[model samples]
Target: MRFRHPDGSIVHLAYCTNVHPAEDLDGVIAQLNGCSSLVRKELDVPVLGVGLWLANTLADRLANSSDALNRLKQALARNNLEVVTLNGFPYAGFHDRVVGKKVYLPDWTESARLDYTLDLVKVLADLLPDDASYGSISTLPLAWRVPWSRTRDAAARDAFNRLENRLAQVEATTGRRIRVAIEPEPGCVLEMIPQAAHWLTPYSGRSLIGLCLDTCHLAVQFEQPVDAFAVLARAGVEVVKSQVSAALQIADPSDPAARELLAEFAEPKFLHQTREYGGPGVDDLDLVGELSGHASWRVHFHVPVHAAPRPPLTSTTDVLDESLRHLVGGAHPLTHHLESETYTWSVLPSAPKNQQELAEGIAGELAWLRGRLVGLGLEEIK
Candidate 1:
């Protein structure tokens, strides 16, 4: 899970644990024992990096009790696992029956979202590796695009001010700096790189606030990876972390069977923001909404990067490859943390039938991404 970039920087690769959603602290511990152990063994490495996802209940426990925190640390050490990053996007109940828009609840305008993220910062500070000087947490972009206003922007600014103060306190006390990376999705207020740049211009040089670039989201919007990276760099926006993920792309959107093929993934679990590639941009609520579109479409659903489900239903792995090349193949690398995040493993149309198969799929993705990095003139260090 450790690699030496051509720039002489050590980058850590991890697979996001949000794929295995847990309800409480005990469930999370179970994952470290069951899933994490399996993945480490599959990789056949002495140590593996895991980007953990802590729900509200588990985070609250770790933040309040030193014993719980120590238990988690011990678990990680026992399983030859380490954590330099976390998926703090989902606050609560991520595995419910229907998590449609509730994932955006308690937006930045509310104090709850700020409190949850602050808690994550505290936990990440404790869980960082010995040689690590910093950690990362990827959060939701401001909020859902609808029901947004200029007044909400002011509220968001206030929240950021509070978070900045807290981050300073953490760094001053622990000497471990943690940055909160706001991840941009399709229908969020800061969907594309331009919108993210416009809102983040004010916090130009602030190290605690930056963007978490997800390749799947960019591909869904039809924005070329190199073009997006150029825009971010030109805007002085730093990418604190990058999620190596792939989205579902349709070759022919006008075909009715293609719509049916995409519909099989439209479960009641999460939001699938579907988009079409006309001369202009096309938007729809979900994949089912784009069934009538005549142009090509891509869905926000994260799929396995190593393989496609079937013909006419391919993945956006090419975009992910290009993004990684731009990020690390330069004279200077963008970020030191790369996490493979395919959280929709269980919800995929032709997903693995069992837990062992799921672990194999995730390990395969991490290996595939590692190979991609190695092919770019980087060396994998055991």
Candidate 2:
């Protein structure tokens, strides 16, 4: 939440919590408060903003809208946390419907969805103080829910139109010009940087509709950090929010080599003969094979199963640093939240080392980022 420059100056840094450990309001607030305390004490900086996950928290509290809004307001006020931006929302409600079917006819007309989305935005906008800024509410492409093969130019155009129309309503209702960040995800219609740029061509020059560059998603698309940033800049797409993450590209466990090896050990013929003779058949052979192969493949492709004092060849630090540099060096002033969204952290073998690792990893990233930002003449928090 804060960073210090080499010159000994301090500045407030903003970020979000992607790992949701709490489902209740009190629990969520406690987590936020704890994070804020660490930022204030350890980082020695003020908390500028926080990102909210709408799907898990807000959606559940929908029936108690007034109470939910009040609780959110109280949480922010108590922790001295300001709303930087909100990601998953309005769109997440129809996630299953959109992704399950290859079409995104939003169950409502463009006007209807626009009104509904805006109404929700208004409630969130009202939650923030007059001087506070709200970052992008997600603007999902219709094709995001649909399959890639089914996403044609005509469908894309219609989707874009619907998005633009709804965004306009959001702007009107909020009475605050919030950016509608179009996030790119793997397998979604806007999977690649080029695809996202192409879709944003009409609104690229506009500030209202922008892009949210999520590193993990981009990694999945095999986009290099520098190249991805360049594409956004070239397209004149404003990055409303930025996330940091690493991808784990594991080999398929059911590949030929793995299958053959499993077959060799289990030997289907042996199992059949044993079954006929009422002998001890293979004990859950499928489960054994799956577990063994998965374990083997995980160790084969990812970083070493153990941690090293020095950085490993497979460490994602370099790419993450490059991404931070790209943002720090960009012309547009970086607003919103710089979320440490390494969601796959638990999947990594080094995750069980306790809170020290979590704290150290986050602090290390912030330290590296601060150095870059300070080099760019941005004031750092002490």
> Which candidate gets the maximum TM-score versus the true structure?
1
**Predicted candidate 2 versus true structure: per-residue lDDT over 256-298, tens digit per residue:** 6544433333322111101101112222233333243332221
Candidate 1 deviant stretches above 4 angstroms = 279-292
**Model 2 vs. true fold: TM:** 0.65
lDDT of 1 by residue, 1-382 (tens): 8888887888889999988878687888889898888888998888899999998778888988899999999999999999999998888888888788889887899988998898899999999987875799999998998898989989998998889889989999999999988899988899999889777776668878888999999999888987888888788888899998999999886677776787788787888787777534434435345255667778888989998867777889999989998888777778888999998988877778977888888889988998899998889888
In candidate 2, stretches whose alpha carbon ends up further than 4 angstroms from where it belongs are 2-13, 56-64, 89-120, 132-134, 138-146, 149-163, 169-174, 248-313, 330-337, 352-364
What are the lDDT scores of the predictions, listed in order? Answer: 0.86, 0.50
TM-score of each: 0.96, 0.65
Among all candidates shown, the one with the greatest lDDT: 1
